[model samples]
Target: MSHADLLPADVPVQLIDPDGRVTASADALPSPEALLRAHEALVIGRRINDQAYALVRQGRLAVYPSSHGQEACEVAATLVLEQQDWLFPTYRDTVSIVSRGVDPVEVLVLLKGDWHSGYDPVATKVAPQATPLATQLLHAVGVAHAATLRGEDTVVMAMCGDGATSEGDFHEALNFAAVFKAPVVFFVQNNEFAISVPLARQSVAPSLAHKGVGYGVRGQRVDGNDVAALLSVLGAAVEAARSGEGPQLVEAHTYRMQAHTNADDATRYRTDDDVEAWRSRDPLLRSAAYLTAQGLLTDDRVAEMDEKAEQVAAAMRAGLMADVQPDPQELFQHVYAEPTPQLREQAAFLAEELSREDAV
Candidate 1:
């Protein structure tokens, strides 16, 4: 049977609408003060997103799946988790990965073709950004399930795109997590189009969150562009999982403002008018307006933050351009305790090639 075979009753749960107006407010909703404090990280993430897009233009990045308009989902996802929690990110989640305490420059290492995964996963408590769609869902569930068996207080949060919901691996992960009552959170950033396919064509279900019910998991839907809403929902979900609650799904309804990647053209399927309409609903703009109304973010403060953003981006660019050579043996070092004969031969060949080039 399909994952949506037994959908939950439809309910639209949104804290704020596209106009930056609150539709519903929970006691758990982040206060203006909290939001103001959180704005810095969001700005930095947004700036980094823009910087990475520019890097793609300059050919510094082989491919960058820019999360331009979805910075709220990225930032909130990062902030909601405790340091001990595990974060599983997809290839497009550089913003969240970096925000989870990884060096920004290193997070781009994978995209730069320097290595498979950029950061130390063990140290960061984050799985490497999964390039294969929904594969990390399985990994996240496995870790959570194992933790549950060990009676460890570990909560795993796995993120995937809207398209990933359709994958068999996602189905298996959710099903298993539900059955095991594993302390895991499945955060689906539903940024409208899955690559080029619109959400309308992607599913006929009432909402992406409802799919959780089919697996006997509770679900939530929120304005993905609304950082406060995301923080509230994700915070609650994280808390529940931490307290021994079963797996849950959060569907953050946001829009993807750019192409799937530098390689895809969004204009091919969506009109400029559609993208323009969402521009007014931009995540950073919405939060900035809210913060400005609270008198928490002054013009001077904004100018300062923007300038800092540019500086950070410039530094990031220089880091990417710097000549920091990785050991050629890195390819074989971590694969196995004892390298297989074939792997040893390949590593030797790579070393020989590097040695020959160095001699010249």
Candidate 2:
């Protein structure tokens, strides 16, 4: 196929507008049950983001990069994946991790500074959330390639921010996936900023999706705030890859409504007006509106979703409030199958110091 044929549409594929009107044909949309599920997930995901932000403030978490306005992308991405599929998430995709069936409290363990990765990756099929930009993309591609070699029917979804697209690892991952026809989808939540750097400074391409054409990957863009649109678009991408169509790149045009993380002041780089503009397009609001219009989101359903969200938040809070006594010996446990002499010496020294402190 020609490179031009592989390019994403000039405009993003948007099924729902900011006001919650269905502007495009609903024929391609997910089933009513799926739509309702996505809407419910949007509600819960927003609550998760809010609770995580609050935890950062209460000194429970080391830091949190709130995906406050990007719940649509998170929910839809998780919903589109099958149980057999794997997800490779970045540090900002905690909502997606929770949606993928990982214990919400365990999902925050890395952010809480408790463990390398709180959950078992082999059981969960989710790699530990990568804090470094674009690193997880390569890992996702490796898993996809290995699955292909083993003749296993596995599709991998790799999540990253717009800033990660600027990293060399992102380029290499796409190139290698394209060359090998790996069954993986690169989901870019282009929230406009990579920390403080805006998307405009990152690439001159019309859209981040366009970069896929260079590596023979099919590219598509969708309104990231529109959960309906994301479900349709991401669903298609995942299915295409699963059916041996090769790697796909999806660029979701969303915005980061909060600071990059708790440590940074968003006011330094963006104006309040900028954030307010996207607030109207809040994923949860639009998803609720759409579902209500469809009669799938009744008052009772809304109350139920809210109650569920509160329960999740309460559980997360309680989990974080509990004190964790980490074993210092765990540092050396996973280093190697057989400890090296240096590692053994360090472990012994740490043990001696701890005993000495106890005796004192």
Candidate 3:
């Protein structure tokens, strides 16, 4: 299909409006049941995000990034992937991984500072979260390239933030994917900031989707808060990549509804008004509105979803806290597959210090 064939020339690739109205492609996407499920997943995602923040406040976790307003971006995007596909997600994609079948408890293990929590890629086809921004794009390209070489049907979905579009790794990954015709989708969730830096300061380009033009790859921007729109666009992109059409770049336009991380002070750089404005366009609310409009949701159903999410979140939080009372010996366990001489010496030193304190 030509560039003009896939999306309307003027609608900016939207399938759902902020007020829960549907467009042409929206009906072609998920079923009402699926949409309701996505809504429930967003509730779960938000609860997980909220719980992590609470844990951070209680000193149970080192840091937590909020994906509060980007639930549609995460769930709908992951919905397009096949079981054989691979995913490379950044720290903000907890919902994506969860929606793609990764256990939430295993995900928490990583956030709670446990090495054993890092996912086995062979089991999950999802990489451990990349904290350094945009580096995972290169890994995604490499994985896709390998799949092509081995005549495998596997594709890759690499998730990043809008800020990541400015990274050198982003540029390199795009170039490599385009030149090699790698089966990859570079999904960018433009939540309006790189930590505290606003979108304008991060890039001169009016839209991140335009970045793909420089690499000769297909690109488009979608309303990230619209679950139907995200699912539609991602489905097209995933199909294109799997069919050997090379890479596609999807820039999901959304906003963050909370601080960048627990350690961040968003109030210092952005106003409460700014957050509230985006909260009005929140993915969870939009999905709930859509479901209610379709008669798939009721107040009772919403309450049930909220209660279940809360219960699961509470259990995860309890488990996380139970593990947070650090085992001093654990410091020696995973420094290396086997400890190095220097690490072994440091572990011994720490052990001796603890022993002395115990004796006293």
Candidate 4:
């Protein structure tokens, strides 16, 4: 109904349009081979999200937040990141985690209700998925500040959702980053809704990108559905931070085509038309169209990708079926490095009860 009510004016910094057109950029294009790899990653990332959604329906996964329309966000964010760079992701960031070299099987662990899925933060430099809203932003800022104090060139990219911006932690993290000149990129994927709350209700600022100015951080709103745009913006942001230009906030504008989580039902608050509207701008479709237009994708290629994705999905399903549920006693074993006396007693009590039940 108003200028602010409508989507923010699309900016020219983006390299890809929804029409599948490739716009010119001053930055050098990645080599054809590298571009091909990026495309392949997108294909795999999409399959990973799709299978995760199916697993949720089958009850193999406890809860899943689908990134079905956010492949570009994941691929682009990882593309510009050096292996040494740190990534802080929320629950929906597994696609980004996989792109950052995490094993797909391992990524599913957190979703399967096992704490063992969290990779070693020191080993992967990927902090475990922050389930508590925008808290990861603070963690990322801390890591970046440490790197800054050490005179290191590394950058930290923290990923969160539109809803997270409403939290106090988000503001605190941004303020800390700005004050300390932390080498952090606060990437927010503004996917229209945070759970069921529309962006309109989430913030009155019109654009999350504008919020960066309040904290003295640079901000840019990019087309999240455009892989090239994401790559370009994230690359610049990373380079800027590494060069001591300070933190940047990137608000990636996109839409969530699925429910907030497996437990959520969009039908309760949104309509089919809203979902269908976003479907027209699906990230996978836009990427496929661009590749096809460039003669980089063929019918045969499509078939091959589909077959491989299906095979991988089937294998994952099989693995889930054959997975041995962890012993209940394991819960106590990992509670402490040296078991506390109370914990040991509880463990012993459980063991005795199980043994008695077996004897009966």
Clashes per prediction? 0, 0, 0, 0
- Could you give candidate 4's per-residue lDDT for residues 6-100 as a string of tens digits? 23335625675677777765354555555556677788888988888888788888889988888889877887888789999998988898889
Error of 1 at 305 (Å): 2.5
RMSD to true structure for each model, in Å: 3.1, 1.1, 2.9, 4.2
lDDT of 1 at 89: 95
TM-score of 4: 0.90
Compose the digit string of candidate 1's lDDT tens values, residues 1-360. Answer: 244533433554566556656667556568776687567778888899889888878878888999999988888887888887899999989989877878888899789887667678989998988889999999999999988888888899899999999889988999999899899889999988889898999889889888888788888887788888888888888998888778888998888888999899888999999999889878888888777766889989898888877777988899887777677688788788888999999988998999999899
TM per prediction: 0.91, 0.98, 0.89, 0.90
Candidate 3 runs further than 4 Å off: 1-11, 324-360
Model 2, CA-based lDDT: 0.92
Alpha-carbon deviation at 209 in model 2, angstroms: 0.7
Ten residues in a row with the worst lDDT in model 2? 23-32
Q: Sorted by lDDT, highest first, which candidate order results? A: 2, 1, 3, 4
**lDDT per residue, candidate 3, 1-360, as tens digits?**
464432323345766667777766545767777777778888988888888788888877777787988888888877788999998999988888888888777786777777675568779999888889899999999999999999999989999998888899999999999999999999999989999899999888757887887778888888889888787788889999998899998888899888888778889999988887776788787777778888889989999999979987887677777844567888678567978999889889999999999999
